[model samples]
Target: DVKRGKWEAPELLKEAKSFINKHKDSNTKIGKLRYMAVEDKASGTGLIQSISKQTTLPIRAIQRSTDKLSRTMDVILYVEERRVWLPANAPWLLNYIEEIEGLTADWTHDHDDQWDPTIDAINDSLAKKPTVFD
Candidate 1:
């Protein structure tokens, strides 16, 4: 896990590599058509470059315009309507659900990082057209 302190580029790169390797099969399945989006600022720039050079995973740099709450709220309807689905018996299932439940509009929590990409993916899907991924 990434600690809440200063991080060097090398450290971040190593962590990214570990994460990518850990999910190698899924990454391969995701393929070149789908991108792994990263914020287009600060360390994210380096991360995109590093991941692109070191792994086969495609990377898309995203420039976030809206605040966290607004971004998350955009997908709230999907969640409420039970359109969002989680893995049936994943090990982290309970923790993931707890994080979703813990989210507040007031930005009073620490799970935003974990949930941001999920919301982004859902919004991106809904924006284009409703689709399911295995």
Candidate 2:
């Protein structure tokens, strides 16, 4: 919780690893993203609170940019919603990051040249703003 925004992404990743090492147990993973059911969609109070408390990230920051920060770190315990879920068997959403590029999805396709963002179809889908559902 000390050096969140202030620290570099790699440092934050280390923090995430430390957090995950402490939290994850049998039948439960800490770093992986999960679908969460919330009480309300408009305010997003419960969901935000849960994520904030668990991730040690401020709600405002999470609200502003969720994926960017999350992709780098490994031990983020925050909960996203079903809205973020891609189509059935979304091979693109395999992972949240890459070493060469900035924050980007981990595509499952073997033929893909990840460096070519133009061919990455996942970006098109992600370009659409996330819809809040109840």
Candidate 3:
């Protein structure tokens, strides 16, 4: 899949390093607190909702966190080749290959019938629309 935003490798690396440094000490009270569990409760609902609405920080922070976790890898889905390729350097790829293969198989089974086109139906549909891509 085409990523909508640009990838900044340096910034991502810096953010990853910072995250590691900040979280390296697991004994801290703040680190021990499960933010996700807390955020799921009724009391935290309003706080979570308000935070989500008020700032772009959450999405940016998540993207940064994902970038950090992945380290050197880039996530890519090649549409033309109908293949999902992951770098050999990325060890996590091994863990997900089976899942990715299953997804491709499922997608092909679901969409197989849609590939055949009828000329009469195509022409009729074309006549109704000024431009198909639009």
Candidate 4:
């Protein structure tokens, strides 16, 4: 789609606003969104800033410092220990599982792109240290 055309800031803002509104109307609570911080050599700060202003949502622009393979490897123990859970019957479940299953240590593999944020979510939201009840 990049070759066809890419979304401009205004379009991105509109889509973000609509999506947030839908979640709000449905009583869904979304936590802070983590936007991968663009590197100094890249050109996306303006877009992220614009969307932040338009949505007024808690958006954390974070730079991923660790290597993808390392981050991917860290979650394995959590999965083996049953700390990661997926919603049953979710429409995206199959594709998500497929992507997870397709992940490999090979740097050339394409599945990492689909799994980066997912691993982030697992690390940030789900895979916490055990409590007594847990």
Off by over 4 Å in 4: 1-10, 25-44, 127-134
lDDT of 4: 0.59
Model 4 per-residue lDDT tens digits across residues 57-128: 555554677887787778878787878777776677787788778876677656544576667767766665
Which ranges of candidate 2 are over 4 A from the true structure?
1-5, 26-61, 65-134
What's the TM-score of every candidate structure?
0.75, 0.20, 0.24, 0.69
Backbone steric clashes in candidate 4, count: 0
Pairs of residues clashing in candidate 3:
none
Please give, for residues 2-88, the per-residue lDDT of candidate 1 as tens digits: 222346889977876776566655645334234567777899898888889877777788888988878777778888898877767
Candidate closest to the true structure, highest lDDT: 1
lDDT of 3: 0.32
Model 2 weakest 10-residue run by lDDT: 74-83
Q: Where is model 3 more than 4 Å wrong at Cα?
A: 1-77, 80-85, 104-134
For candidate 2, give the lDDT of residue 22.
52
Better of 1 and 2 by TM-score: 1
Report, for every candidate in turn, its global Cα lDDT versus the true structure. Answer: 0.72, 0.35, 0.32, 0.59
lDDT of model 1, residue 14: 81
Candidate 1, residue 23: CA error in Å? 3.0
State the lDDT at 106 in candidate 2.
Answer: 60
Please give the lDDT score at residue 3 for candidate 1.
23
